[model samples]
Target: MVLRSSFFVASILLLTACGSGGSKNDSLPSETPEEKGESLYVLNCASCHGEDGKLGSSGAKDLSVSKLSDQQIEQIIRKGKNAMPAQEAVLETDENIKLVIEHVKTLKNKP
Candidate 1:
């Protein structure tokens, strides 16, 4: 009886350790385009541009006060501005560039 009880407890513990009761979807929720854009921006742009887009390090412009249109911004991002490197290689896709543009727009200072 003692050995049987120990075996049952061990089995239960093993199953619990294996995440038996966890949700079927163990993966984290997919990031929204905005979230992904912010992440990409942080990885690629935040060092000079800052988290709020106002740091302006290494001659990086204050993005919070930027007035460039989306098309202009897209051009700069794809081609390379004065001090900024061309991001076509870094961003890889137009979709990613658009997402980053959307995130950058959110950094504008409120009136």
Candidate 2:
């Protein structure tokens, strides 16, 4: 009876630990501005926005040399517009959002 009880407790503990969402996968990728922006952009924006961020999908506007200021770009990213999905939640941090705007600024116009 004691052995059976011990085994049951061990099984319960193992199950609880295994079921816990303790994996590092969901944790933030980077803390620094550049790293944070690069990581977020790569994961969320690369598909339609392109790796360079200027080659938008068909109707999407080119971000390079955009007339918008960084604040405007950041706001648009956070709030989204038209077909674009709001990213305030996905970008997570304000600093990181700013970082993304800064990175986007580097996407200079093509010659």
Candidate 3:
């Protein structure tokens, strides 16, 4: 009976160990602001906007030459425009939207 009890306890401990592995994000190293923003943009915006934000696929704007203010960009991201779809649901939070905006700014062409 003691042997059976020990085996049961060992099985439970093993299961607990496997179950406590945590989420995928928990295993990743913390990202810098630029890294985080660029990652978010790549995941959510790269398809239409391109890596340098100049692909302009499907009527997407060329962000490299965009002159819109930050507030306007935020509005367009949250609400979308023309062929673009609203991103509030896709981005999931205002903080994420801001991150994408920061990355977009980095894509602007220097004079």
Indicate which candidate wins on TM-score. 1
Between prediction 1 and prediction 3, the one with superior lDDT is: 1
Each candidate's TM vs. the true structure? 0.75, 0.63, 0.71
* C-alpha-based local distance difference test score of model 2: 0.78
- Residue pairs in candidate 1 whose N, alpha carbon or C atoms collide under 3 angstroms: none
Q: Model 1: which ten-residue window has the lowest total lDDT?
A: 20-29
Summarize candidate 3's per-residue lDDT along 1-111 as a digit string, tens digits.
999999999999988877776554477688987898899999988899898898899999999999999999999999999999999899998888898899899899543
What value does the lDDT take at residue 7 in candidate 1? 100
| Tens digits of per-residue lDDT for model 1, 13-100 | 9888778457556666789988999998999889999999999999999999999999999998899898999999999888999999
Go through the candidates in order and give the clash count of each.
0, 0, 0
Per-residue CA lDDT of model 2 for 7-72, tens digit only, reads 999999998887665755667654677776777788887777887876788456777657898778
Model 3 clash pairs are none
**Candidates in descending TM-score order:** 1, 3, 2
Clashing pairs in 2: none
Q: Which has the higher lDDT value, candidate number 2 or candidate number 3?
A: 3
